[model samples]
Target: MLKVQEIRELIKLVDQSSISEFVYEIDDAKIKLKKNTTVTTVEAKPAVQQVVVEEVAKPKAVEVQAVKQETKVEAVKEEVKKDETIDTSDLHKVTSPMVGTFYQAPSPDSDPYVQVGSKVSNETIVCIVEAMKLFNEIEAEVNGEIVEILVKDGQLVEYGQPLFLVKPE
Candidate 1:
């Protein structure tokens, strides 16, 4: 909806113009501004879907309502097939316990708990999973030699996401 100040400015512009009537339509809403010798009439209808702001400061904010529809892309699927870089077969996977950001080191200044050739035993802290400001030390459930770090530091990981690949000792 336009402000009264903006509506007044519109009335002034219309009064000075040769055009007698001005009609504007967006989505399902419509605005009709009419000028006569005696009086001026402004008619506007409410918008349809989710509100969207189109222009700024002419009215400051123009609210528009629209329903969004998502379209599937075949190109994204093809790109995923091309980016197949890892071979997860013949290795034990260390997956995430919860949805959070993964961190290799206990702190930013410290060295990573595990690397490509790092050896680990059951109960050994291999990484930290930070969720909601709490840092959790993730343990190596099985004794193994680290073969791969599947997730990068500061990457958001989902529950059951593979974080590392280990060759059992």
Candidate 2:
């Protein structure tokens, strides 16, 4: 919807213009006016989808997405078997955000944070990097399929260490 000021501006443009039709747009609102025309058209557009999204439970979605990642990884593995270098050589890498003790799982008994062929988004928890007894969840920064696990489970990792190689989706 256009503001009162915008409608006034449209009117001014219609009056000054020698042409029969004039159109203007600002933000999501579009304005069109015609001179020497009796018929007026007023169309209200439906609500627009916002670009800046606020996701409340992104982490849970990431975790759930991990379930299907294995299948995608399998497909990539087959492709990798065709050409081995294709998996790691040209892949986008995920590095540890901080210096810590790298852990594959929350606990030793649990499954590791992520596995090969895992599909992940920026909200996905790839693994936990423990530092000073604080278990920090490491998230995937890019949406991709995990091609390789760089570090060993329960290995000591340094800051900015390569953790996973991902192929951009």
Which candidate's TM-score is highest?
1
lDDT of 1 by residue, 61-135 (tens): 323211111123456666787786556577788889999999999889999998998999988899999999999
The 10-residue segment with the lowest total lDDT in model 1: 62-71
Backbone clashes, each candidate = 1, 3
| lDDT of the structure predicted as candidate 1 | 0.81
Computed on alpha carbons, the lDDT of every model, listed in order, comes to 0.81, 0.81
lDDT of 2 by residue, 1-169 (tens): 6878978877877778788887776666666777888964544555677688787855687777886798799988999888855546677778888888888888889987679988889788999998898999988888988888889988898888998888878
TM-scores for all candidates: the values are 0.50, 0.48
- Look at candidate 2 and tell me the lDDT of residue 169: 86
- The lDDT, on a scale of 0 to 1, for candidate 2 is 0.81
Q: Model 1 segments beyond 4 Å from truth?
A: 1-87
TM-score of candidate 1 relative to the true fold:
0.50
Clash list (residue pairs), candidate 1 = 57-60
- TM-score attained by model 2: 0.48
